[model samples]
Target chain A: MKELDPLLHSQLRLAIVSLLLTVEEADFVWLKEKTEATSGNLSVQLDKLSEAGYISVRKEIVGKKPRTTCSLTPKGRDALNEYVRTLKEYLHI
Target chain B: MKTDELTEKESIELISRMIEKTRNEMNGDDFNSFLAYGYAAVAISIAVWLLTHFTGNDMWCFGWFAMFIPYLLSFFKKGKPEVVTYMDRMMDSVWKVIGSMFGISLLIIVVAGAISGIIDFSMMMPLSIIYAGIGTSITGLIINEKWFVWTPLAGLAAAIWMLTCGWTGGSYDNSWNLLFAASFLIYMVLPAHIVRHKISRS
Candidate 1:
């Protein structure tokens, strides 16, 4: 049996990647609002995905506040596609 | 969502729901932009219609210049790329293309009308309405909005009817302007309200 990609196996990480897939990029606040995740928790998960090369995180100063934006990397997109393809097999849909 | 371990089915469901959420939030200000343009179109068209009616002058036709104001405001009002979704970008591209095509067509009609003398300033009114319909139809297709697709057809039909009837009603000069106003009302204003309602509900 093929196993799910470990990086995307977690719920929050998966949701983050899914959300980022639909948009060009997303800010920390926007992702936090969409996933309804605590700031600290979302930050940690985002870091894990960043380390896994699933997403790129950019930190910059914007209008007197530090802002973080996340975007799906090409590797991350492929992983997502493969993950979905595997899931379809498991679900037999 | 609980960041705990998820089953295959649970993970799939989560992904699906999150994607839906993203789509809903994509065009956050589109409805507002639509409403602004809708009201502007109706207002400017009506004012010009009345002006032409009273003064017997086609110079009021320049009022169409006001239509681009709403579009300019919309461009400035757009959210940053980090916040704008792929769908929003697609919608923006669609409108940009439509606007460009309309502008080119308008220039052609105006210059041609001036040279030929057969196509006057007043004739441009109905033609513009028909072009508006074409734009609406294209927008509808891009957004998968069925009503938008059909709405423009009605405008085109009315414009054609007015043209063929040769201003069947009272003032022939003002008839096209009235048609333009009516199309803006039915297509733009009414759709704007419906979009507002949907946005509110969502």
Candidate 2:
């Protein structure tokens, strides 16, 4: 059996990536709320994904507040699809 | 959901749950803008019709100027979430195109009527009603809302009724305005309120 992508195998990181798949983009607050993750923890996972080139994060000022928007990169999409494919294969379904 | 290692079934389940949750969030929007515009459109149409009837002056058509209130109010509102989904962007684009079509069509009809000196300005109402039906129906289709789909049909029927009455009675201004008012109320306002109520409940 082939090994899973360790970077995407974690629960929170996988959930974040999964959520991004359905939308054009999501802000930090939305991600935090949906994942029910603490701001600090979500920030850390986002950074790790950013470093791995799985997602792109943009910081901009909307009104007076700094807004952080995250989108799933093409690489990230391909990884997710491939992960699902491999997992399906493992399950023999 | 934090886990050191997920089995194959668990991974599939997690992915499915995440996708489902995200989709629900994307669709979970209150129809604030729709409700505002629907109510305003209904009110303006009826008010203009009543003023025209009571005053016996054609100038009451200018009451349509009030319809801009709800349209412009939408811009000043800040309820839009920072995050937008694919469906959100698509719905926004749909409404924008529909709005532009109405603006351009109205401008063309008015300009043609004025320059040719042969077209009746009152004729614009039926055409506008038809366009409203088309727009509402298209929106209904895009959103998968059957109520919206039927609204356009009802609007078109009202427009047809207005045309028939004008042909038979020689003057159908009141009927035209009344039908439009009813259409806006039934297809736009009522459905918007129902959708908003459902959104709140969900």
Candidate 3:
């Protein structure tokens, strides 16, 4: 089995990626709300994932309201799937 | 602790809390707004017909103007602010613009009908209402919202009712109002609520 990066193993980052994977795309606010993380915390984790090239960010306006949206990159998706697969193997579920 | 210094567990907990808070904020406002517009379109259309029948006045021109109110409210007010995300706003805007186009078209048709005298002015009311429904439903389909299908279906039913029942023969009876109410309640009101609920959850 391929090893998962320890940096990607953080619980908050895992939840962020997991939620994004299910929804395909989500806003920073959505991620903050969904994962129940503080705005500052979510931002830091997002920056980490973005630096790893696992996620992409886009900023745009919705009805004169500014918003930041995030989507999982191919690498992020692969890493998430691999992480879940490894966990499943370990749990034998 | 500063967010940057917080452990992973704290971050996860915070995000989970925000999602729950936002979800609770989802009221039936959008759903009700849609229903209000749907009902207004039908009611105003019928009211114009009744007024014309009694006063022998050309009130159909005013019906078109009445229909514009709900459409404007939906576009400018409901769901405009809370949809903080860009994609969500884009999707919402697509529906709004489509609805506006229909309103404009219906206004044009009403004016043309009034001027040309091609059809009885009384028929204009029901026709305008039916057209509004058609426009809403088409917009719904364009946005892939299953709830929107009901508007057109209700419009079709309204059109059929208007055609079969003669205008002078108590066609604007209480039963017709009941039917209008039922169509809006079941088709527009219920489905819109369901869709809004789903969007809130996601």
Off by over 4 Å in 1: A38-44, A47-53, A56-69, A87-93, B1-10, B26-30, B75-78, B81-83, B106-124, B161-172, B198-202
Cα error, residue A7 of model 3, in Å, equals 4.7
DockQ of candidate 3 (2 decimals): 0.11
Model 2 residue B77 CA deviation (Å) reads 0.9
* Candidate 2, B109-198: lDDT as tens digits: 778988988545566667667776677777777778888788777878877877776788766466466778788888887887877777
i-RMSD per candidate, Å: 1.8, 1.7, 6.7
Better candidate by DockQ, 1 or 3? 1
Query: In model 2, where do residues sit more than 4 Å from their true spots?
Result: A51-53, B1-5, B110-114, B117-123, B162-172, B197-202
Better of 1 and 2 by lDDT: 2
DockQ of each: 0.61, 0.63, 0.11
lDDT digits (tens) for residues A1-93 of candidate 3: 555456566767767766666444677776676667788888988998998988898788876778888888999989876765665565454
B61: Cα error in model 3, Å: 4.4
* List of chain A TM-scores, every candidate: 0.97, 0.97, 0.85
lDDT, candidate 3, equals: 0.61
What's the candidate order when arranged by decreasing TM-score?
2, 1, 3
**Alpha carbon deviation, residue B177, candidate 3 (Å):** 8.8
Q: After superposition, how far is residue A22 of candidate 1 from its true place, in Å?
A: 3.8
True-structure RMSD, every candidate? 4.3, 2.9, 6.8
lDDT of 1 by residue, A8-79 (tens): 988899999999998888899999998899999999999999999999999998767788989999999999
Worst 10 residues of 2 chain A by lDDT: A1-10
Clashing pairs in 2: none
